[model samples]
Target: MSNFLLQLSYLIGSITFIVGLKQLSSPDSARKGNLVAAFGMVLAIIGTILFHEHDGNKIGNIPWILGAMALGTVVGWMMAMKVKMTAMPQMVSFFNGMGGACAAIISIVEFNSHPDGAPGYLLVVFLGLIIGTVSFSGSIIAYGKLDDKIKDISSKALTYFNLLLLLAIFVVLGIAVASPEVFGHDVVWLLLGLSAAYGVLFVMPIGGADMPVVISLLNSFTGMAAAFGGFLYNNPVMLTGGILVGSAGTILTVLMCNAMNRSLLNVIIGSFGGGGASGKGADGEQVVKEISVTDTAILCAYAGKVTIVPGYGLAVAQAQHICHDLEKKLEDKGVEVSFAIHPVAGRMPGHMNVLLAEADVPYPKLVEMEDANPGMSSTDVVIVVGANDVVNPAAENDPSSPIYGMPVLKVWEAKNVIVMKRSMRAGYAGIENELFFHPKTKMLFGDAKDTLGKLVAEIKEL
Candidate 1:
């Protein structure tokens, strides 16, 4: 009866995971969906502790497991409560790396426990070890980059070196798996080291702009490793959770790659953008037009339609809430305000949406790139708050640019554009925004949060 109950709990947890995942598709239901999935995970953990058994051993290490879980929970909660919005990507990478490390540790313990396993079992263990280690190391590197602790570096030689290193790891894996008896315990350690090294090499050559894709790919790797653990232990909940995470992460990675007009192979080969476009001014020369907050506020107050385009700068300035405040003030005067969100905006997919939703922006007011572009011509004002690459105009106009084919927000199509930023620095892709020099564009130089707050005050005074 207890065994049956455990299986039943696992089923319920799996269903919740699926339902919660589906709910995350919309911003309105996302928070609720996350809670539901977390609840399901809690259920799984409890059911496993009470009922899981293998050869009647029953995971006899409850004290350690409980203590570790508690510690991790406390750490996670503290970080979530204290972390700034700009550091979200870094936090994600940290948590994902922890998950990968856990999976890799499982593989290590299992392989050691079963010194003389079946050939197929050995293969599975090796697979988990390699993939999990890679995810763990690569995720750490990604976290460093997102936190600005590491520079994005890529070269033809480095790319080729990574490819060779990957090949070597696979070769060693094949040899070890084929002759487990001869390879013995040391082979696993050797593989683990090689896998970890490859992970660092793989991510180090990837540019910062490609970090989003790397995050998703590493997530998929962790999921796959966990699935292998499930297979090893014959745990249904573990298998289901792993499969869900793996599949979802892979799908998201593909969507991000497609949005950037790049292929997975090319990304892996380190042929994509990671460094910003330096000194590549739009049309070889720039003629900037500056706008004061007073004038800008007046323009927005009277405009029929105003579309806001947010980027990494918005997050950096922690300005989403005030931007929303600005939007509300504009709407009071009967202006139509909507957000134009490029899929690849900010550092990750759905980044802008998440930021805006946090600021209580209505879901309907968030316009996707494709839908926002067609109506841009009619938009009287486009407020670009701390965005550079998405509104750069290089993607559409410069065939010689690295990001030439990527789809971008058409903020330039609007009649008037107000770009707010701290300075005249290149975007994440290291390219100068041609839109900045466009005849109709106006620069508003200042901190985004400060400027938006001032703009809100100015609009009220008007």
Candidate 2:
């Protein structure tokens, strides 16, 4: 009866997982999908704890596992609470690293348990080890650059170096795994080290603009690693999780490429950053006019209908809540407040929307690019927060910009535009934003969260 109940639970969980994934594909149902997925996870955890019975002879120690879980939970919860929105890209990279590490550890443990080398086990372990190593190291490098812990370095030669390192790791792994006894157990450590080094080298030379694509690609690697581990252990839940992550990551990569009007090959090879044809004028100075925050706020407060655009800067400022507060204040005064969202806004796709949603912003208040475009010309004010590449007018006007053909928010069409940014520096595409220099545009140069709060307070004065 207990066994039957466990099987039944697993069956129910699988169905929920499938349904949840389907629902997640649509924006309208995404929240429900998340809830369903959470429900499924809870069911899976209960079932596993109840059904898993390890004989004392086979599994002598459980304390370490329990302790590790507790430690991880505390760390994860703390990080989640403290991580800023601007640092979300780095946080995601870290998550990818953890996933890969988990897979790599599982592979090592399984290999150690079976020194005789089963063909199926060897293949799974090989795949998991490679993917996990690459994902872990690549993601760390990505995180470092995103967090500004390391400077951006773009080199054509780095690609070739990455290829060579990959080849070397594979060759060494093959040799070590083939003669584990002759090579001794130390070979595993060597293999792990080399593979990890290769992962770091693989991502080191990529520029900041390319980090998003790299992150997505690494996410795929993590998923593949998880899938390999699942096969090694014959765990259906793990397999499903891996496949889901892999598919979602792939789709996100494609979407990001589209956002830049580039292909995967262009992203991988051209290392293209999106910008106008003029790009960086002498000494990396983007040619855009700048203005003061006081003037920008006055412009927004006086506007009839306002559209707010959120980006990583808003997240970093922890200003989504402030934005919400300002929006409510505007609405109270008979202003039509709506948010314009680019599909690929922020460091990752839908990143800005996720931040806004987390702040409990109304779903109806958020509008997509297609829906928002027509309204831009009629909009009295468009407030851009820490947004760069997505709102560039060069994409529409400049033939020479790398992102010339990409669709962007038509903020320039609005009667008045206020952009809240930190500096005159160009976005990831390393190209000047023509919109910044527009006659109707004003720059509110400051921290996003603080500026939004100031605007909210200033609105009270109105």
**Clash count, predicted structure 2:** 4
Candidate 1 structure quality by residue, lDDT tens digits, 1-462 = 778878988998998899899898876798899999989989888998888777766767899989988998898999988988778888999889988888888889988898678878888888888999999999999999888899878777887888888898888888777887666788889989999999998988776457799999999999999899889888888898898999999998998899988898878884556443433643465578899999999999999999999999999999999989999999999999999998888889889988998999998999999999999999999999988887777788778677778898888889999999898877776666778888989999999999999999999998
Candidate 1: 10-residue stretch with minimal lDDT: 274-283
Q: Which ten residues in a row have the lowest lDDT in candidate 2?
A: 52-61
Give per-residue CA lDDT, model 2, range 182-241, as digits (tens): 666565676788788888876776663457888999998898898887687566776887
Best by lDDT: 1
Candidate 2: residue 136 Cα off by (Å): 1.5
Compared with the true structure, model 1 gives a TM-score of: 0.94
Regions of model 2 farther than 4 Å from truth: 1-13, 26-32, 35-39, 42-60, 82-86, 116-120, 170-187, 273-298
Q: Which candidate gets the maximum TM-score versus the true structure?
A: 1
